[model samples]
Target: MQESTYNNMNAARSSKRWDNWEGHRNQINRILHERVLKSSSTDFCKAAIFGAGNCDDIDLNYWLNNVDELWLFDIDLESVQQGIERQNIDTKMIDKLKLFQIDVTGLDKISFFNDINQMLKDSTPIKKVVSYIRKIANNLEVIDDLINHYGSFSFVASSSIHTQLLYPHFNQMLSNTKDKETLMREADYLMSTLVKNYNQLLLNLVKENGTLFIWTDEFELSSDRGNLHLLPQFQREILNSNYTFLSKFIYNFGLKGAVECNKDLLSKFPNFADRLIDKTYDLIYWIWHYDLTKHYLIHCFIIRL
Candidate 1:
């Protein structure tokens, strides 16, 4: 990926997400309140977030009072800047806020630095936009660099980024290749390995005994009437994946049974249970019925450790 890919985000994308956050602001804050603030172990002096873009859903005031520093990370620096400005925070308060523009998944590292340089030099027609991504598809590798760099956080949170593991890369491959079926085939072959490695990366980012709160909206189910339900399943899927595969590797389960992830065959990464503080965890799977059609099953994991 180009340095530009590493540095910033697409303006349209960052703008649209910010707009979406405005409509979702209240519900997001409400959920954070219940899951994080209500938790007895939510206090921390400094913290880092992987998908802390726009900060629309982040609990700024809580951090302001409890934390001495708050690090906001995203692929888009502009979105982070918008979050800082939206807070209307004072200069002294702003000093505690540090912005990191990065794609935690590691393959997407083309920064705004690359984009600006390409424009200044007048590169090929659309190479600046398309080339970096094409390179990414071919250059993918296992990554666990978050632990090497910003490894520790008192409290870690994921804002709908886990299930999005392969989505962006999948989309980019579709766009660069412009053949959906071909891209799908490639994804079927490539994604499991990528996802397994990425999932490991996510877990390793947590500290040895820090609190982790992950809320993800994935898993869809359909009713008899043809309506679909978007349910949450990060923890369940992870547990199932771990149970299915790690059992085979570590416990030597029978090979007669079959299980799948994303309708693809399943394999396990390291189980998260080994990382839990007391292994006393709570998983809240509840639907946030915003309207008749826009119901989201929020998969909330309150893991102490």
Candidate 2:
């Protein structure tokens, strides 16, 4: 998707989701308040959330109450405005909630999608497409104007968009290719490059000793792949199992192949295990019943840097 189209897609999705997810919203707000905001010692002068579409899973009032300034970044401003309107925040407090429209992935800055669409339009061979993505991946540089302009924040959070950064690109390529295996390999490389740099961007946004809260949908559940009926049992198993055991369970249950993004292969993204302090971080999982027919397994990581 081009940046404009992606923003429009986000706005449409936000409108549909605006009034739903009450329980999910409360759960996410509670987790962040208890596990990140309350646990941190940084002066609550500034905080920010990337991919803050419609801000459904956040308690806007609480954020305003805690931070002297709150920044919300999404590709579209309409959705952020819609989110603020939904919260019914006091007019006085509205001053503290600043909004920025930007693509956090920097994919738009590099015209990643546009290049690929052009290649496909020309019917470029799959090998050349693969090489193109690799070239872009190797040369990728995160846009830093956010830091240059607004400086760092006391707290930084990403609202379940790590997977989304690479999704549209993969879907676009998939639509034009029959050799899925070859495309998957290149998409995997691109996902790694995008996610890793995105992670670093999150880190860069945080002030020293501040906290970063990253949550993402790591796997899916439904009748087709892993029976959703077995979800309860699977959740129970994970509760008692260590990380190693959990990895084995995911593989044994055939979940590794079914996820939108396989956790084990993507630097265990969002978990940011590589940045773990003393091998410790706050981690939690919950089910997002996307609708009557679909469900997602969401996990969040709380890292204090």
Candidate 3:
């Protein structure tokens, strides 16, 4: 698909619906603070968040208390604005942390347009066509401006919620393209943009020995309903190449016996009135013994940079 089309689709889909999974969000943040932040000596002064949904801002504020400068960037500017307001964070902090609405899928539009224009200039019809396409492609500047403004950060984080939504849009856009090789090439290019953006953010923001924390849903790795089964190699590559092992913890539901305990609580509170009671018990167990078993294998890792 053309870069312009992809960016519009990405922006539209992002605006429609996006949210942080509450249970998973808290669990990951807890592990990050306890295992990573507490152990590291480097005080994190700056942080950047991609897909900066409202809930995630709350999670970051709760865990990363030392962060003096916070940058929130997302394709959906309204969402970021809502997050800032909902969190009641100081406007000064919001000002210090620039927000950019950037689409990461438009890396080569300028070069492609310039090349096409130069090649077709002698033919009026071709020139007009190329000029139209160039206008469409050039709209990618919305995202380019984001990269220019934010530049980089010390800590960068993004949740898997983006991949699940964006990948299908990309796949659909490429499905009808005449050149299969070009379609695949574009797909790879977009993915590389994500990696490059993430890597550059990490490299620029993180101190030599700083940490990068990625919080993803446990279901992404589960066998029965997990997408991880589809790309086992890619999953392994990310874990192996990008991160160093620190510690893993589970949250929300407990490992094994804890699940059973939750089940029992549900049984006792079969009616709606017992909902709060059951939730309280589950919360207590999740906080205390979630890391002990394999059943609740919501993995949380602290990676050393």
Candidate 4:
């Protein structure tokens, strides 16, 4: 199976040194333990994380030591290795970390990247492009090698990858194309389809009564825009009230994609919330201080399947 071109592009764009994101890593680890690991009675014998890019957002040592085996899945395997090396994890625990170079979207199986490139080269009409996207999304099938061999995992997580499932590739493909309005409409449909399927794949990989942790980078706030400085106050108010405040903030800042990015994951709640252990507080929100310049609005759900 060919890897999606966008995955490789994403790997290249990731920073080599993760020293700056220590706080974000710690925050992620703390939440996983509090919300998914310690609260549950399930034994996380074999755990897997999709989109384990560079493994920076997670606590490698804790997972390696706790789980009987830790499976890291990403389209780029090298990033996983570099992550381990960066952490200076003990070599003994390293054996527990299994790596799978796989695309969770299964786009490669249908030749999505190749097809898009060919379509662009041929100057395919917007109508045909929309049709192609719908066809591929409808026929999508995610192949899991781990299940047949190792069976379902005891614990599973998706590391803020839902928004990434389609947008980057779509943008890369339509960069030079016309008919923005039509393409955006089709992109929304394709993304909705992909998110549903991707969510199912995560659930399928979990054993009965196993815990699944999923999060997404819902929106971005940048210091460059001068509003990131307000996060300290805004976060408290936003959380104190409902998320309705978020829309106002977005409008004030003229930030694009926040609403759609948030809805991408939030909309799935009704379908999947039945299995959620603590619906009252199952969803957790935080700020991922990505760097000195940018922070991401992140929300996570802890589901028991």
Candidate 2: clashing pairs of residues: none
Native-referenced Cα lDDT, model 1: 0.50
Cα lDDT of model 2 by residue, 155-259, tens digit: 788887776776665565567567667877787677767776667777778787787777776666786664678678656755764556544544454222223
- For 51-104, candidate 3 gives per-residue lDDT tens digits of 564434246456345566666655556655765555666444444566766544
User: Residue 250 error for model 1, in Å?
Assistant: 26
CA lDDT of each prediction against the hidden true structure: 0.50, 0.70, 0.43, 0.70
Whole-model lDDT for model 4 versus the true structure? 0.70
Please provide, for model 4 over 1-305, each residue's C-alpha lDDT reduced to its tens digit, 9 standing for 90 to 100: 23455447546644633666677777778876676676545464788899887777878987776677888888777767777787888788978888888777677766787787788788888689889888876777656644573336877888877766666766766676676668767777777667767777777787876777877776677867666777776688656855556545544542233344345445655564444344533666677777778888776667665
Task: Give the lowest summed-lDDT range of ten residues in model 3.
Answer: 281-290
TM-scores of all models? 0.59, 0.82, 0.48, 0.82
**Per-residue alpha-carbon lDDT of candidate 1 for residues 1-305, written as tens digits (9 for 90 to 100):** 43233224433344444444543455556655564545534444456666675576565665665556777777767766766676778666767887776665554453432443354356444444344444554666655445564446666666655555545544553453434554455444444445445545545665665556666554323353244532334335444544343233322321111111212212332344443344445444444343333444445555654
Off by over 4 Å in 2: 11-20, 42-44, 149-151, 173-181, 223-226, 238-280
Q: What is the Cα-based TM-score of model 1?
A: 0.59
